[model samples]
Target chain A: MLYTPHLTTRKIMPEMQEFPMLSLSSRITPEHLFYIRNHFPYPIIDMRTWGLQINGLVNRPLYLRYHDLLQMHQVSIPVTLECAGEKRALFVPKTRGEQWELGASSHAVWTGVRLMDILKAACILPNAMEVTFEGMDKGVRTDMQGIFTYMRSLPIKEALNPDLLIALYMNGKPLPFRHGYPARLIVPGWYGMASVKWLQRITIIDQPFKGPFQAVDYVYVNTAKPVETIRLNSTIAQPSDQQVLAKGEHLLLGTAISGDSPVLFVEVSFDNGMTWQPASWLDPHESYSWRRWCLKWTATNSGTYDISVRATDAAGNVQPEIADWNEKGYGYNAIQKIRVYVD
Target chain B: MLYTPHLTTRKIMPEMQEFPMLSLSSRITPEHLFYIRNHFPYPIIDMRTWGLQINGLVNRPLYLRYHDLLQMHQVSIPVTLECAGEKRALFVPKTRGEQWELGASSHAVWTGVRLMDILKAACILPNAMEVTFEGMDKGVRTDMQGIFTYMRSLPIKEALNPDLLIALYMNGKPLPFRHGYPARLIVPGWYGMASVKWLQRITIIDQPFKGPFQAVDYVYVNTAKPVETIRLNSTIAQPSDQQVLAKGEHLLLGTAISGDSPVLFVEVSFDNGMTWQPASWLDPHESYSWRRWCLKWTATNSGTYDISVRATDAAGNVQPEIADWNEKGYGYNAIQKIRVYVD
Candidate 1:
């Protein structure tokens, strides 16, 4: 009989768990192992009266009750979600916010109504340039100065892509409570922050949305484009980082994925960029799911060794060696390094 | 005393040697190890009479002698070059062509006059969509029905980018006879095929080129755009692929780079995608140079293991877990997979 690795969840306030890179055996990361990222504690609401409103610069404002969406045309897509700060624990000198590793990302089948259809039904006014989303998960926080509801927006064009959705189900079932029970916005290609949970209201505006989350919080320094794409990335899982092993042969395991395009190749180096060998895929890859790969290494001498991995995506983007340090340490995709001792 | 890895160059007809991934220690790969990929044998010509002519759909056809270009305003930039089939050997079912492994690529500092400057001097006529380059290395081939000179083109806009150059020197010295002696086209972000060597003429045309190199060969099936950017990629040199290592402390060595962007993170997997460990950088990275990284692995057991490496560029492009196989095997950037048995 084969043995399956168990999920690893760490104890934290808003609730978080670092997905062990080893359990990444399947394409769609099971909902149980999916990492959870929340700005505030989960808020529970009565499903009966929970409604999503769309107003502002719209010819016909929409007031959609959760039930109305269920009656509309439905669609599903395998989408991957990542927090603005996924692997922040690896950041040196430390940065503020959740110290997540690769556990901050996961893939699931999202079933919902097309966001474009909703925008069209609202009859977007001519001058509308952005569509904003407001979630029922409201709260006062140290960072978001005033009373605020978790909100975010999309450019008019991006909102029109048929792929974007106001999701009502996750992994073939009703949305999980911790994952926004009634409905949630699923911005396919962007980070998780843009996917407002517990969706409540949406607004179309001509000027850029200046709410705290949009105007300041999610950005790094003055870089306006808030950690949008999941940077070309990979994570090593087996022969656990810094683990002591007996001198012999062992297998190296890990996962790699990108948001902009498909991944092309992954190479492993044991001598500091001197020479690299390729890794084999363990599972078929989907655009949104992280790719699993492995390599066979024969360790002869008993001592400490340094190993490295680098990946390049189909769009021809190469992972950088050093990440540009940001105060909040969002989007930490720098090449990972580690040391292990041998007996 | 420390052991320094030596560069490896395989013997072949057009005179080829796989760049020892180990000796890839510097930003500009040393001259000797740069992969040698020539369509035809070197063509010798008197430098005094060598002139670059600009004609076809142009208001003014200009002819500039070699000496004139040497005296004109010039610029030097670090650019990387890669043959269309750089990693062809890695393709499955083995496609037709050189069957190159990874040595079909190299980095160099090119000194030349900006291609934009020369194009402006030609006074381009209206409706010029493409700019073509003709080289002096004329020869007859099985692919070309008759005798033909190597030529390639760029969309007018790409030709005007100041970064594109009419290179006269490589790595602070006159271009080597075997490496496009007098002058050559240096297309900074494109594959090596676009940089026609031993240049002679420049022509602007309104219609798409139907040349044998562009239409029949250098392409995947009937697609038009000949492999442009080098897909984000990396290679390991030290501890050569499939090398037997003594079970002890060792540093995994390798290099990663991208033609279109700077590399981001690189990770090493010791158990496929199930686990990964970060690798450390051994040298500072530059835009065009492959980055050097090292990771420490402690081999505690004896068995066969597959080690894999993956990289991401700053643009957020991740190395794909697989490569789309092409008939000519051009631009193959599949994640490198290697097997090593540790004793």
Candidate 2:
């Protein structure tokens, strides 16, 4: 293990031990600490030889040197980079695997050259609808498993969002090596995995990149059905589970986002899965991003009760009770159930 | 200085260094990543010798040891812990002091006991409108300066919120020595200063505590001649200042919170003090907590434009163009203005 600082150990306060919490913001200082999940040793990139390649469904398969790319137009965007499995801490039965208890997500002010600028330079064909990002880091699994290249894809529209950029700086400084340095993707408001670090290549295609990383790995399918379908899920960040409440009113708070659609309404339940109440939501105009929501919960009854919350998106999709089981945990948006006692 | 990792230097590719950017998340990790603004160093706390004293305007002045306090009703709350000067990075030249650049906030699942439960244990009396918190940290600025003790007070209503907790654990573990071992106030969604670490005493008063920290420091006053009154202001977390933009449509995002009032609307302007548009808002219920907002803009014209965003509270309070100045940088919510250039 690397020389983990005392701060990293101190970061996990006793009050937060039960759940895995990942800092989501990118303004990393003493207060905005970083919890890193490294699959392999940190890679060192020599800027002298580093270059970016754009190929596949483009008019020109160009190999631009790093200096040449910098000569192009530069753009900065303030976007939220979240981990797709942010609320993995709320998972009950303590699912086995890379034990990630919250703290896997963060937001950042990414400054970089926009990918759209590069695509426009390459003259993207109208038939291109999928964009794939390949990173320099190699995926490491079990000993028997061969090392595979790490990559993920996004819809061309999302890839073309002016907010999306090839990030180079973090919090007004150069990107940390542990984070994707030199250049990485800044897909605001999406899961961390979607923002590929150690970026090497960008490919445009007509269809989704149904590779092992996207198809068998991160994708989730229901356990009960013959047809594999993705399940919607949401989580509550405030008013944590098993919390003891005073005999008064309080605010139940957290954020919700959907993979397939935009969040329309979020409902909170003070009594397990019984009576439900509506939570006030912040509108984002776009349906793909996450929405923050809160509900006024008055603790009239002074006793132990389970507080549960679920969310529905504009596509008439509500968070399910259980997420479909997959080889790799992805799309685990189930009904988040928390226990709280009122005194 | 501590072992500030040279992670960014070696890892960043040379091609990506031209743009300066920062991540949106305040803290990236729990320990070394989170910023600690201590009025004083770590206090040596002995649970056996440590005791909590609750007095003033109450039916009974109760003195309880750590063990005794633990035996009392326990409460846990998942709240976002923010520092008053979180966005110091965005502070313009006229408002530079403590110089904290956006690394002064965090959120955690805090678990422990409630102060209200103890107050209920010691029968409450009428006329209790304010509750004051005192810590063990003491300091004297330079030499010969008067000794100042860190103390703050909250409204009786805010103190009694079921979400408020006397946290003993963070992220679900014992408190670290640096982070007020034994006990501390977890005022979810408020600035970190409000959640005084190294808690020592609690006192109920008939009126708000008018101390230096409360009345003089951390308080914002207008900068106008014969300055008008002090009020709430707005802030953006993503775009600090001088960020680059691509020549296309992009979303401008950040979070804002009003003191003691719910944010009614957030407006964004791209042409420096000219026309403004409403930014999308999230969860408008908790006036005391922060709200995230975003606005979409098309950068068809390629030039540097001053992007300014202001927020209005439900009480009809709007962020000013020129925030009132003070000795310390409190309430520096001058209509936050940033410069972004389109190709």
Candidate 3:
């Protein structure tokens, strides 16, 4: 059993737990404290019998055993995986899903085989528009009563991006039984939903895949644009939500990661978003890894304030002061607002 | 005799007018077009007859002619003088006083000897608690009717600070007739109230000065804290109030001045104050000089917006999101909001 007493657990069926402020604790989250978000209980698997099936819109419908897949190639890549409903607690009228605060995200170094190499070996058809991944774990969702496996799809070009990986190990060790054991798909720049765990099947489709998680669950139907990549964001660690401190000099620590664009600069505002100061970087910049940052703040007055943090990416995308709200409360990256009392 | 066609001249007796946004024209405001905020008609005087009398609690009561005062060692320093009621027009319910907008302040080079030297020469008496200055000009009041001069005072220590000066020159030339021709008192880091024009007499007293400008007029009785030194502030210049422009990349220029502190950073928010971008500097930094800054904004969407600009100073004072309201609309330095249409 993973010892993660610090993380806030919102539910047990899906086994959702949040990561603590890593900038305050450790730069690389240990496997035990790493956040776990599962749609179903850990599936029992035997490496000898476990195999991945690649069909539909492929020149060759190929089936590769787990051991054979691992023998092809191996590389290590650090990636941050965030739940679609990362900050769902911010929604008004109370969103119906897991009401997460600041957890539901984690970073890990995965030793894996290139997903691009497998797709090339399977000879993906030219007509393929999308690629769908199916997990081995199955369960009946509370929202819809039906035996189903968690599934998601990505654009064909994104699915074949060299950044994609099929990992057989976590943090240098063979993958843990609960973390897919034999192998799992690792989609670099998409939400954790696209990184299907307990992976077993892959399908190339000529049109958008209508999986439950794709069509009915994660999409923000109310908004004009559907939710996809995680919005650029950063959060304060030392002054947790509703924390208190004496008026004096203090250091604020946090971490930030943007999906498609590299995190350019992270700003911390002591007085909401009225004025902001750039937080100094604690870690060298990286695309998929969360950058650790901290800023020295001299709290001059004693009053309540919404200490906020927002990030801007190289792509000119500013973390909107207030992220647009959705019914399911998906990508709620409105400047990570933490109210605190300075006395 | 000075040509300033764009200034809104409110009265002929007092000669009250405002400077146009010079960021759209020039950086250092031309002496001729500098905003004129007179409480009374400009006082005419012969240089030989103009003598500054030092009396009351001073160790030696002395009178120095204008020529004798100019003979003292002098230094040039940049100081921004902002009227206490700079942007009073923004107040609702129509606060009394000039319904001025964002043009009542300007920066200038003041050449003079430090007021500290004069105090040292006369040997300020220990009993003195405040030092008062009375301008030569006089007028009848609208709020409190009675013949009165534009007089104000400050604490003895503040009045004798090395930064305080009796300026004899404006922009390297002898002061213009309308701007206190022979000499004027410059109280750095305080509102224009402390910088009395057409200086005539200085009285060091054992109490806080209680002239109409000091007691009944300038003070905001409605608020717990009396309105004082110009609040930390900034204002947009290029995109004039309620101006319209095509949807494209536009540069916004502005200026910010603080009383006791140096302007540190200025921020501009197009969508009210929800989001802000750091504006770039146009000139070298100078204490007391209104900094010239502009930011390149690509207006992608077409709509009306209240473009806002707020500034912070090195002393850690942030321009309040909203200025405190008062009956007289004094020290209106809230985030300068300008509504504009983009088509």
Candidates in order, interface RMSD in Å: 25.5, 22.1, 29.3
Q: Write the per-residue lDDT of candidate 3 for residues A307-327, one digit (tens) a residue.
A: 888899998988886667776
Residue range B5-79, candidate 3, lDDT tens digits: 244343334566666663335566778667778887677677757799888887888798887888999988888
Task: Name the runs in model 2 displaced over 4 angstroms.
Answer: A1-37, A56-59, A65-71, A75-78, A89-94, A124-131, A143-145, A154-163, A169-174, A188-190, A204-212, A221-232, A282-289, B1-343
Of 1 and 2, the candidate ranking higher by DockQ: 2
At residue A318, what lDDT does model 1 achieve? Answer: 74
Please provide, for model 2 over B46-136, each residue's C-alpha lDDT reduced to its tens digit, 9 standing for 90 to 100: 7767887888988888887777766767766555545565444344433433334334544455678887787777676789988998888
RMSD of 1: 26.2
**A1-343: candidate 2 lDDT, tens digit per residue:** 1222221221111101111121111122222344444434445577888888899899998787767766777776645445444445345433323434334444345678888888888888999989999888775543225676778888888888776788877766777766677788877656566778878899999986876566644554444212122234456655544433456678776666654566678898866777888988754434334456777777776666777889887778787877544433544677887766565
Error at A202, model 2, angstroms: 2.2
Which of the two, 1 or 2, has more lDDT?
A: 1
Model 1's TM-score against the true structure: 0.48
Summing lDDT over every window of 10 consecutive residues in candidate 3 chain A, give the lowest-scoring window.
A1-10
RMSD of 2: 23.9
Model 3 scores what on Cα lDDT?
Answer: 0.76
Error of 2 at B210 (Å): 35
Ranking by lDDT: 3, 1, 2
Model 1 regions lying over 4 Å from their true place:
A1-11, A222-224, A247-249, B1-343
How well is each residue in A156-237 modelled by candidate 1, as lDDT tens digits? 9989989998999999989887787798999886878999988888999998888888877788763655767678887776
Judged by lDDT relative to the true structure, which candidate is superior, 2 or 3? 3
